[model samples]
Target: MAELPLADYARTLTGDIQTLAEAEDGSIPRTFTRWALEQLEESGFVSNMTVAYHSGHGVMVYGFGYSDDRSVLDLYTTAFSLDPMVDRLTKADVTRHYRRLLAFLQKAGSIRGNFDQPTEVHQLCEGVEKLLSNASKVRLFLFSNCESAARTQPEPTEFQGLPVEHHLWDLARLYRHQTSGAASEPIVVQFDPPINCLSVQSVEPNLSVTLAVVPGRHLAELYEEHRTRLLELNVRAFLQARSTVNRGIRLTLLNEPGRFLTYNNGITATATAAEFVEDAEGRRVGIRSLTGLQIVNGGQTTATLHHVFKRDKKDLDGVSVQMKLTLMGSDDLMAIVPSISRYSNTQNKVTLVDLSANDKFHVEFERVSRTLWAPPTTPGGPQTRWFYERARGSYAVEEAKQQTSIVARRKFKAENPAAQRFAKSDLAKFVNAWSGLPHLVSRGAQKSFAAFQANVKEQPPVIDADYCRRTIAMGILFKEVDKVAKAHDAGSHKALITAYTTARLCEETGRRIDLDRIWREQQVSDAIVQAAHDLCPLIMDMVIQEGKHVTEWAKSSKCWEEVSRIPWTVPEELAEELLARPVEFAVDTREEEEEQLSRLKQIELSEWEMLADWARETRALELAEQQIATTIAAKLATNATITAAQVRKALEVYDNAIEEGFSAFAP
Candidate 1:
């Protein structure tokens, strides 16, 4: 096995650092903090989270500790990178960090400006106090690029008797993680005897599930101890945004405590491993401790229960929560965790991309990407490879470990010609660019990515080898156009320029040239290259007419969308303006010229009708027509919208849709 050098490993672990020593400069602490978080999220310890730097009271990174309903961070957390910033990371430094954290927590209740607290700290003080006041346990994570040592004070379970948990992500732990990408050890919790009674049975090899009726208080305590780490990443990603669901769950608990269990579907949770306290006859009496506890579903319900108990001071004396806890080997857990999260909460319309991290399609794509290589760019040169990271951290792990046991850790990036590598989002842009809808390509990456995913699910054939080749060619063309445009000082309108130019050129070339053949040859034609170089100035002029302010016009994707709807007559109009002056790829004969004109006119006619239909339906026709005529002296045109019948066929192909359609809203 090839061992990755520290520099390569560090680069893989943290994109910003080049060498292990670089991490010593206060960078590794923050980088490792993120890496540990990724491990936590992947291991079902926490949900997908965005850390806000400089938000947590001079802390480097701060956000909600948990993913479910308890999103508010009561645990005032921070990290100190011990490099040049500090000569040594001693117990004293750790103590001061915690002291600063406690001092902030103590004054969190009142936002009074007694002393000059940073705006971030003052703003969060009141909310932190409220979350902590109702909190069963608060946790402070002190991440550092330093060795772990004895604490100045005994590492107490409680801070001033408030049940505070301390977690240290020190340099040694980080070093092991960086080298091997090992998982964070699961937090184990022992169940009290007679724990609401349960039945257990093996479901698969190394997998057993227990069915039980757990008390609301028991569930609340568990969530409090683990916070958001209890929820699976998908559930957290779905529920992290503040919503009215929290209030609704709280109201139900306070007003109709008896109906809460019935109203809520309870929780589907998992554990990496489990132990049972058995009776004399070997009957399972109670669960001793569950390692790596994670709630795959019902995050909202758990958080709501915790919120009601903590914030409202309400007693859950008679409340109970239905629990389905599955115990599986850590290896098995990785394979099916996302699937569990996907099907667990049918009530929420979770976006497919969020649910698609472990999706077979992505897996297959990664396989194809790694296996396929472009022919050597020069004779005897090594064939170039494309890396596709189906899951996060795949590249670093692969480089360091040279393995693919974890689907989520595979990388999809190539070392040379870095721009050739495509992430899922970039793949979406490439696909959209060639789907007879370059307008979608110009809309922006996020929108394009969502659209592309819908296409993938609705159209599996969209990702075959031929399609991948075309996407690579499109990337090549896009990059070249961008390079050419920048050379001519095109500025912000560069993308807009590249997009329309490609669309119209593709339209023109299709009449005489076979587009598929170009991709099949894996070669960008000289004519196309020439066209891209020649078209930059002309497209810039068109953009100026449509948008006087180059900056605003360049940034306006919405404007580009409107412009693309037009029939794009500029190519033909420019040709006509130079008709007498022999154009390089001009129609050589009368019949050929007529044929090209006929196709353009046909396209223009259809575009006018489509524009009119779209305009009549949405009143955008007038605006589209105005932009087109003003910019290129053409009518707005668009590809026909997908018909309902076609959509039905797609649904049938995928076998998806609500089997039993119900009313739009429950009465």
Candidate 2:
């Protein structure tokens, strides 16, 4: 699809920001910054970000955070224009913004003492001072709602002897990022001197493998440049010397540099494309460049090498590590990379749940979201569905596909409003908060998602139609309470307030908030909103009284414990309306079971056969379970009557097959 014109896109974006700001009772810049940060976090451009706007004395910042490993520090600022027609941000404007952000970093120590009463800004300055003391690199980002007129980025410089990099995300750039439908902008690495490698021809088209030895110094430099982006596909983050493997890597790097190559299980990496240099006989000998390089395995070795090089000041002169590279096309990256990551890891265990977006639970949730029509808020009004974006850009992609017809696009938007769309991380946040995990929600999206996934792995939930409706209800409730928190105080830490308030409400009300009613009405009642408002300040006071950085304090389970201990009861009127017990919307078990069985029956017989064969081959099921699957497939082939018990057993076997890496036949 062709890109939208800059002016048109800007107007649309402004409309979105306005809608969001109005909903949250916030300003344009804060809303825009929060929105952009969500996108960046989703794309792995940043992680564990905290939105805290502070501007004064020729300094300004909207957010701050560290890389997952704390090797790089990031600060964010915005150059938003109220005028929708505004098209270009000049180089002078860009420089001023960059300098303002830099000044915040430079003067954090001095300005930290200026605030007599602790504020979010003061907390941010304190965080900056502490994190910067050991940071090896810093990044300053300027997010603008206008296209940048500057053609070239500022050269990398140093702040307090640490390297500083500048990045600008102008409107045009953000537009591409939203529509590109890729995880993140590709990371292209160019080698000054081509390195030798041995290539193996693969039978599969557009797939090749190669083996190469890379110098330890070069590996460290690459990690410094890319940070966690190189490990995007890897399930686990850098353990940072806590694990025996990392400690051993550090010890070897410091004690025996030469044997590092043999001692390490060489990294397994994937690239969208690779440039090769040929020898005199026309044989591919060296690799000159790699595009979209992602390390599927050996992230610990890579991270530990960089850690020793930077923190321990160990020499990497004789250190060399082997690497296995798989080259494929860009179209195949998402489809093929996760399998490689899941199987290649030798140092750590990677579970199916860690794959997250592709897990069966999410797939089932997405399916329910597509098929279930939410009741119209008013009689004779059009019904809509809450769009569950299981993948990053699925909503945009679906919207783009309808652009060929104006009516189709209009219908699509009416049915799936932009405000109703939520991503997987958003679901994680809402559910975690309601499940009395405000501390985990406070840890930011990626970490919270990791925690949520681990919990699900331990205690899996059935993702059914009723579950989907109730999940959307929780989202609606959280958002309404978010407005209450913002109206109480529009500054930083509103997310923490909303999370704690909802969690406390659940605790105080005994999880009897009538979610079925909320789902049917498509919003929370006035009493719940009032209850949230009543709890907001109390939660805020508890958070501030902890005498810790608000972000840091909110991340502690102890904070939740203290907040839960606060004496707050639901108002009498709200309590009288609360359900005696949580309501189950699916009242007709027979009909629900019939619906499920119908869905299973809709799957082709060949697909069921394929599933059975896979389960038998992988030994994912017990012998009895395998026989059950085979029986179901045979019954389907013969149009035989299948019992409800058999159907349940078939589903269990199917789920087991999915958990065992079977995806050839997904129902």
Candidate 1 lDDT tens digits, 91-158: 87777676666665665454335423323333244335445645455667666545546454436656
lDDT of 2 by residue, 276-297 (tens): 9998997889989999998878
Q: Candidate 2: where are CA atoms >4 Å away?
A: 1-5, 238-245, 353-360, 378-382, 401-414, 454-462, 567-571, 582-667
lDDT agreement with native, every candidate: 0.53, 0.81
- Model 1 is weakest, by summed lDDT over 10 consecutive residues, at 579-588
In candidate 2, position 270 carries an lDDT of 88
Q: Tell me the spans in candidate 1 whose CA falls farther than 4 Å from its real position.
A: 1-16, 19-71, 74-89, 99-139, 150-165, 175-187, 193-196, 233-240, 243-252, 256-265, 334-357, 371-386, 391-397, 400-461, 464-667
Model 2 pairs in collision? none
Best by TM-score: 2
TM per candidate = 0.52, 0.83
Name the best candidate (by lDDT).
2
